[model samples]
Target: MSTPVTASADALHRAATRKAMLRLIPLMCLIYLLSYLDRTNVSIAKSQLAIDLGLSAAAYGFGAGIFFLSYALLEVPSNLAAHRFGPRRWIVRIAITWGALSAAMMFVRGETSFYVMRMLLGAAEAGLFPALMYMITLWFAQEDRSIAVGWVYTAPALALLIGNPVGGALMQLDGSFGLHGWQWMFLAEGVPSILVGVLLWFKLPERPHDARWLSKQEADLLTARAVSSGTGGGHDASRITLAMLKQALLKPFVTLIGAIYFFNQIAFIGLIFFTPAIVQQMHVKTPLLVGALSSAIGVGSVIGVLGVPRIQRWLQRDCLLLGLLTFGLIAGSVLFLLVPTLVVRIALLAILAFFGKGVLTLYWTIAMGRMQGFGAAAGLAFINMLGLIGAFVGPYAYGLAESATGKASSGFFVAILASVLGLVLVPLLPAALRRADAEASQSQRTSARVMTADSPVV
Candidate 1:
């Protein structure tokens, strides 16, 4: 009787743990969905906003792209701040502030106001992704992390799929609720994030220690696993100083990875920021339909993010990336140069997007695998910082190239160039890391077997 009761209680606890983790996935996805919606709504808004405000294409492009400037500057510090105060406070604060600023777009009648609001949006959102990444580090083990990260990261793509059409539809409503369609677009998309922010304040567990669903034994096991993995989480004043920053910045591996991400972002951001406009150039009858077609990329991204981790598990990590990069080069070239038919172009764009964004999962996994201690967060921050520089350049360069050539096709060539550059850089990474990863896997399997053999019966 006693043994049966104990087994039942253990099962109940396991179920509860699973339930808690499952709940977090949707909430995190929703949070990121809103974040992307708020960030990229400006792109869709540009359709009506430029005409309404009498702004030039270059000025509009500048305003749309400048959000990353403040975001890049504050990312590391903001991540550290989130680590210090805990996600519950900082994440909620970020959400509320960005949400309100987004809603404030209703009053902007000129380019200056647009630029100011965008910068404010950037400052407000600076900490979000890094903080979320930190949160994932806390909740998940290293082996489980890539898939979890992929799901959270897929939210932006999902938002693009949903938000573009929604924004386009809202923009069609010229004067609803005593505001223009663009104003309504901002209000509708932005206000929900604030509400979700409040909900997150109540819902998010700050750490495993605080998670009611986790048994004391489970929490202790988690902390022990982290320590053994060399990612233990006590606040260390020593790690936050300038010396640590200098060391992280100076590491050759770190710099190489950062450079890789920088070039990768040029292609990624170019596709995302300009896709709708490109689709429009194909002479789609309605802006809303074009927005929906643009969303095909997001659908492809979701498939990529979910699929890459399993691919990495089957193929060696480096080999998987090599294949992805090859696919990217081929698909991107077709999208840019060969396919003249609109339907074929859209299908090929979807294929390119699926593989292109899928590679990011592997990129992040490789970076995290290389780091130790405080270096994990610092390294991720550096890569993102470098990536944002490319993010800033990609859109504006595409716009400028489009204007210069008087053809939208010119932008695709730039994307193709970036994809080819990424393919060239992948081989430069250390081959030994791949071998080391394989050995680590073997050791982990042996340990798991021994642990299973040694556990005592109730």
Candidate 2:
């Protein structure tokens, strides 16, 4: 009777743990979806905003791209703060602020107002991804980290998949409630993030210890698993000084990861910011259809994100990256050179989205595996800072090139260059990090063997 009861209780506990993770996924997805939507809505709004504000293509591109400049500068400090204060408090705060700023776009009139609001939005959102990464470090073991990271990443794809169509519909809602279509788009998209922030404050547990849904035993097991996997212990809460920052900046693996992230962003942000316009160039005048097609890239991203963990395990990290980078380069090249049909171009874009996002998953997984010590958080923050710089530069660079060449194909050529750079850089990272990982695994095995030999049998 006692054994049966114990088994039943164990099953109940397991169910509860599963329930907690399940509850957390949608909320996480929602947060990421909104973040991407808010960040890229400016791209969707570019057509109408450009005409209404009397801005040139370059001016509109600059306005759209400048958000990441402030975002890049503030990322490290904001993430460090999340590390020190705990994610629950800081994430909610950042989300709410960014959400309000996003909605505030409705009030912008001229170029100055647009630029100011964009910068404000960037500053407000600086903490979100870094904080999410830090939170994952706390809650998940290393083995589980990539899949978890992939899920959060799936948001960008989903956002791209959904945002354009939604933005188009809302934009068409102009004159409803005394708002322009663009204003309506901003308001509809931005308001939900604030509400999500409030909900996150209530639903997100600060740590395993605070998760009421988990039994004490289950939490201990989870933490122990994390510690055993080479994370979740000795996370120093000391503020990062200039010297510490320099050390993080100087690490070979960190710098390599940043380069990979930067190059990847160059391709990604370029495509995202310009996709609607690209479709427009293909003679697709229907903004709603363009939006839906653009969103399909996100759908491709979902498949990539879900599929990458298995692919990583099979090919190993570096190999997986090389393959994906190759795929992106080839797909991008074909899209640039061969495909002229709108349907074919859209299909190719979806393929690019699939492979491009897959490459990113591999890059991030490798970075997390190599990132060690208290400075790991800072390393990630700095990577993001550099990556956002690429994000800022990529779109604007493409727009400027378009302005000069009077053709969109110039942007695709730039993307091919970035993708090739990623292919070259990814191969170099394994010698620096993979060798260390191998040595560490050997050391751990030797330690375990000695300990096993010395243990007395009961």
Best model number under TM-score:
2
Assess each prediction's global lDDT (C-alpha) against the native.
Answer: 0.74, 0.78
Q: What TM-score would every model get versus the actual structure? A: 0.87, 0.90
For model 1, residues 1-458, the per-residue Cα lDDT tens digits are 69997787556545544554686778888888999999888777666776789866566667767787778888877776776677668989999999999898787889898889888898899878767766766665566667777888789878877878998888888776577888988988889999999999988887778877777866765555545554554337444778776765666666766677777777777667778877888887676897788888888788888887778777765544655665575567555577679888888777777777777777666766555446666667777777777777777767777777765556677677776776676676666455555655886799899999999988
Tell me the spans in candidate 2 whose CA falls farther than 4 Å from its real position. 1-20, 438-458
Candidate 2 C-alpha lDDT tens digits along 1-458: 79998787556545544554576667787898899999999877777887888766677777778899899999988888887888789989988999999999999998999889999999999978877876666666676778778888888878888899998788778788788889988888899999999999999887778888787877775666556656565346775577877875677777887887788788778778887887777776776877877776777788878777767777665654555665565576566567677777777787788787766666566666655445656777888898999888888887887788866556787788887777787677767686657866896799899999999999
Name the best candidate (by lDDT). Answer: 2
Model 1 accuracy (lDDT, Cα): 0.74
- Give the range of the ten consecutive residues with the poorest summed lDDT in model 1: 230-239
Q: Relative to the unseen true structure, what is the Cα RMSD of model 2?
A: 4.0
RMSD to native for every prediction? 5.4, 4.0
Clash list (residue pairs), candidate 2: 157-298, 160-295, 161-295
